[model samples]
Target: MKLTETTFQDGTPVDGYGPGFFRIGGQRYEGAVLVLPGQVAAWGGYEDTAPLIAAAGDVDVILVGTGAMMTHLPPAFRSALEQAGIGVEQMASEQACRTYNVLLGEGRRVALALLPA
Candidate 1:
């Protein structure tokens, strides 16, 4: 997918998914099919957000962006996700920030936290 627009999720015109990465409101992301949270994350966000994406379409994995500077995944929850055949990847908010766009570019299905900057 080639995301024609330079900036996504900033209220500017949203372009279809395409190649290259993107910066979402100053946070970098890949050009993958990412699920953006309307707001930041909390304990329930992970469970809440994942199913939303799953409902949207078929996905092999869901990248969970916890929040700024956080990178820990509850073991049981992680295992459950795995058992369901959906791999879960948790990155520091910053890494999530950067990788979201890149993974999108790679055509990966990702879910992002809409944390405030």
Candidate 2:
């Protein structure tokens, strides 16, 4: 088997993540984070959908990392995003990170709202 490295020309890809933190661009972020094409910001969990909403026109989808487990987001939250005309996909945080990287590499207009595992 052979391995090929993943590159990020937009800004940075999530370098690593475990337990309660994620690493990107050599910086560590504790708790949740909102990752865009060329930016990453602290996310306030379910309560903080404003940032995502603000980027609705800029992104095609938002991948939500629901910590260590795959769970559903609140109905209101989901509805709000739907109302903004943005797509939402939820899964375990780790998977979300991987998916985000893959989508980003393809140059998709995607965002990641990740909760620490």
Candidate 3:
């Protein structure tokens, strides 16, 4: 599956990562969106970098989830996102993914901000 296009501020098309897709906001991302956990680790470590980078692609809202269990988006990570001009929201990884799915289903352009396990 792929991150399909959805109606949102960005108005850009969403592309999927691979099989077993997870839709957030309105975009579909499969597998792990945090393809390069090491590259931007300092931004806030693994807990913050993943979703921030993934949202860089073509997403309107990047809902960041700091960890596998219910977690919070680190303060530093939020600052980076604010500077990047990407609107961000916070939620758990599981919740973020589920929200992404709903946004996708609703034709909303959103991306999942998650921390890799």
Candidate 4:
């Protein structure tokens, strides 16, 4: 097996994340955050679905980081996004970050909604 340097062609990659914050493109964001191709914004958890809804056309998948543990996303949230035609995958926050970066590096249309660990 061989390893290759990870790179984001046209998307922002998550550089690091901690208890309540995430670093991206040399900037750190606190609280739950939403990451798009080149944009990072605060996320309001399950209550705020508008951002994801609006992003449906731009992203094919959404990586949901459920804090420090892997848990199921609310059915309503999943339904809402599925209804809008966006695929949702839930995992631990840290795992989500790594997956998001890998997909982004491949130039796939993906986004991340992370709850800080």
User: Could you tell which candidate, 1 or 2, scores higher by TM-score?
Assistant: 2
Model 3 residue 94 lDDT score: 64
Relative to the true structure, candidate 3 reaches a TM of: 0.51
What is residue 37's positional error in candidate 1, in angstroms?
A: 12
Best by lDDT: 4
Q: Which ranges of candidate 3 are over 4 A from the true structure?
A: 1-32, 35-57
Q: Any runs in candidate 4 off by more than 4 Å, and if so which?
A: 1-4
- Tens digit per residue, CA lDDT, model 3, 1-117: 788654544322233322334343345554444312122121334454545655565656666654456765567777777677777787655666556656755766565545543
User: By summed lDDT, which 10 consecutive residues of candidate 2 come out lowest?
Assistant: 5-14
Predicted candidate 2 versus true structure: per-residue lDDT over 1-117, tens digit per residue: 999877777546788899999997788999999897678889988989898999988899999999999998999999999999999999999999899889878778889999998
CA RMSD per model (angstroms): 8.8, 1.4, 8.3, 1.5
Better of 2 and 4 by lDDT: 4
TM-score of each prediction: 0.51, 0.92, 0.51, 0.93
Clashes of each: 16, 0, 12, 0
Please name the candidate that would achieve the greatest TM-score relative to the true structure: 4
- Model 4 C-alpha RMSD vs. true structure (Å) is 1.5
| TM-score order of candidates, top first | 4, 2, 1, 3
Predicted candidate 1 versus true structure: per-residue lDDT over 1-117, tens digit per residue: 876744343222112222344344445445332444342223244454455344334456556655544668777767766766776777655566556666655555555542322
